[model samples]
Target: MTFDGSWAEGREAPPAPDAPDGPVRATTSGETRRWLRPPWVRLIVLLVAFVLADTVVGGIDQGLDDVPVVGLPVGVVLAALVLFAYVKAIRFVEHREVAELARDGAAADVRRGTLIGIVLFLACIGIIAMFGGYHAGWGSIGAMLTTFGLMCAVAAAEELIFRGVLFRIVEEMAGTWGALVVSALIFGALHLVNPDATVWGALGIAIEGGLMAGAAYAATRTLWLPIGLHLGWNFAEGGIFGVTVSGSHGTVGLLKGTLSGSAVLTGGNFGPEASLVAILICGIPTVVFLRLAARRGRIHPRPRRASAAAAEH
Candidate 1:
């Protein structure tokens, strides 16, 4: 299916005042051609925007962490800024209005995603508990609040970087499957820097984090669902359950839990994100979401320069 460029309304040239005695042609020789940017160029611009936003927000996060009783508020503000920056960047670089990031039904989508994430994590915990790998108890409220703030920052940042930027651009370049594979692998590889990160953990993260989150975006065509899912998972795993998250410390949580068993089942220090149970549980919903996306024709076809050029003439 060819995109006839009609989607970018108002950018097209108006009809000539002195009409020519011929069929109207939208040729590529003038103003219309200027908007044609390659996907790679857009990707580069997106990366630059992401880095700038991250650097600025990271500094703010660090500063806020130093202050007492202000981390949550600071994190909330920074997360909002990061999301705004991402949406603005996408709109500017894509040269079109990004309506997919709209907030009309965002609350519903977020609630749905959050519920799914909580359920999936609960299943992982349940499986581990059955295997004598988890014992749960409570922790301090202050710690839980701090972890919630931090997890919100991490979730918003990652979803913007991975699903919002990388997955979106790569999909335009290489189609949906290509986007899924490339984005997922990169997401997994990025976690290698975490303490106790193993090859298995990375692979697990690829399936659970990358594919699952990308699938969420594909199904909804919005960032809110994926953001909610990511936020929910990390907050539940670390903030609530008091487990390691991607081989990093949980810092503070509501429920304290000890995990002991085979690394395959327990995910070791990398948390449930690396466990086989997580993959199985999360994979089901991921597959379902991808199928829904396919059914809805949400999977974009790769752009063809030849077709585009033909359309121009």
Candidate 2:
């Protein structure tokens, strides 16, 4: 499907008075070519690649489990290898350089601020625990570590596929806002498979999680910021703040907080991610990032270039 911005309002401006106006033909030259493989085809290939690789690794690990020599760190090694392999495969398939995927003008503070956000998120958890007066024992430390590892594995795969590859492809075809909304909707909708997901929860996911993270990617032009933010948000929500990260609660929260007042404020069992507070927390940063990205010309008007050319002639 060709996108000529005809359906996009605010994209068309009045032609200049001296300009010789005629029907303009839209060319694909300015459009990004990331969609050559087709979106669904790319997704299928990615799934097959990861699943096949992981299955082979799992089979090998099961056979060597009794050996006791490499079984302990085997899972971690396999996970790292999978990520590395997937990244390389994606680069090869997409035919785009890794450096091209990154935002060249991103400020260092974007990275630094991500770290600070994680610390602040943890601080919030601690403060909430103190206020709510719930204690989590150290004996559950092992469970927490295991759970963290598993969640990281799952989240990394999904994020890399969706936000990293798919989002960029669509963004290249569609304008920034167009890609942002469509991809963010898909990202949020994918979570419907999670248990106890509600309309509000899904909306929360769309606005707070997907939209916000898309803005982060747009601003930074790298996955690191969004990945860091996502990790911190989930870890703090589930691991530290004693809330469900994605409709699934941790076996033991690092610090516990009772939700006695309001579900809208605290996010009840659906977790803080479903709460309006979460909307504020996530939405605020998203708005800030959106402004910054806009200033940097990341989300500028697309057809404006054509209008400028028309004026020139």
Candidate 3:
């Protein structure tokens, strides 16, 4: 079986105003080129590539857990290589360099995003503290460093997969708003597999990870901001504030903190990321980023089809 299309909306030039209107042609382009490199196909390929590479790197890192001296450096190398796989896959499949991972302005973007993440999480923690649920005491420096490394890897991999691969392609086909909604829902769903994940907690991750982070990516068209933001947020929650990340248990953070209060404020066993305050705070920025992205004309329009049926509607 085969499919045909006459046009791919938003991908090609529109007809001239004076050009004579004609019946939509049954497209041979998509058929011949195998669906004109369908966005869904590209999404699947890229996602598979990134996930596979990341999994391999993770396996290697985990395997080296007992090889004390060479482990960290090797893990760092693996991480870099995993990122390289993403770049390599894009070039190979998309036939272009990934502008999102481009080195230009990366440092500044990462730094800016990291700062925002730290400050935002800190504010959330502070607000929770006001309710007397958050308590902080000194924690292990070594544990903090370890947590930082882990957070960095988590941030990079996640941003690459969710924002870079998933949201980017979805935006190309469905526009920015659609991409954000999709990324958020899927990101939230993924978190449901975490320990002690509640529907509310998953929803919180959807807002923070999907909407907020996706908006940040849409604003910049770069992965650096979301990555740094993810890292900083995770580190701030687990490392500095000594809170559980998402629903992860046994997270060694910078401070030994304790929480005792309503689940709404404390986030229950799922962590402060599930708190209402966090959702509201992060949701506010999501709106800002999306508006900024729109004002900057960064949003992609929905693909148009050359069809009478579509036109009549």
The 10 consecutive residues of candidate 2 with the worst lDDT sum are 19-28
Which has the better TM-score: candidate 2, or candidate 3?
3
Per-candidate Cα lDDT values, in order, are 0.74, 0.56, 0.74
Model 1 scores worst on lDDT over the 10 consecutive residues at: 19-28
Ranking by lDDT: 1, 3, 2
Q: How far is candidate 3 from the true structure (C-alpha RMSD, Å)?
A: 10.0
lDDT of 3 by residue, 1-108 (tens): 000121122122232232212111112243344553777787887788777766765566446534435654554565566678778777666665566777866776
Error of 2 at 135 (Å): 8.0
Q: Give the TM-scores of the predictions, in the order they appear.
A: 0.83, 0.67, 0.83
**Residue pair clashes in candidate 2:** none
Per-residue lDDT value at 208 in model 1: 94
Per-residue C-alpha lDDT of model 1 across residues 178-256, encoded as one tens digit per residue: 8999999999998998889999999999999999999878866777789888988887887778888888764447887
RMSD of 2: 11.0
Q: Is candidate 1 or candidate 2 better by TM-score?
A: 1
lDDT of 1 at 296: 57
Q: After best superposition, candidate 1 residue 89: deviation in angstroms?
A: 1.9
Each prediction's RMSD over C-alphas, in Å, is 9.4, 11.0, 10.0
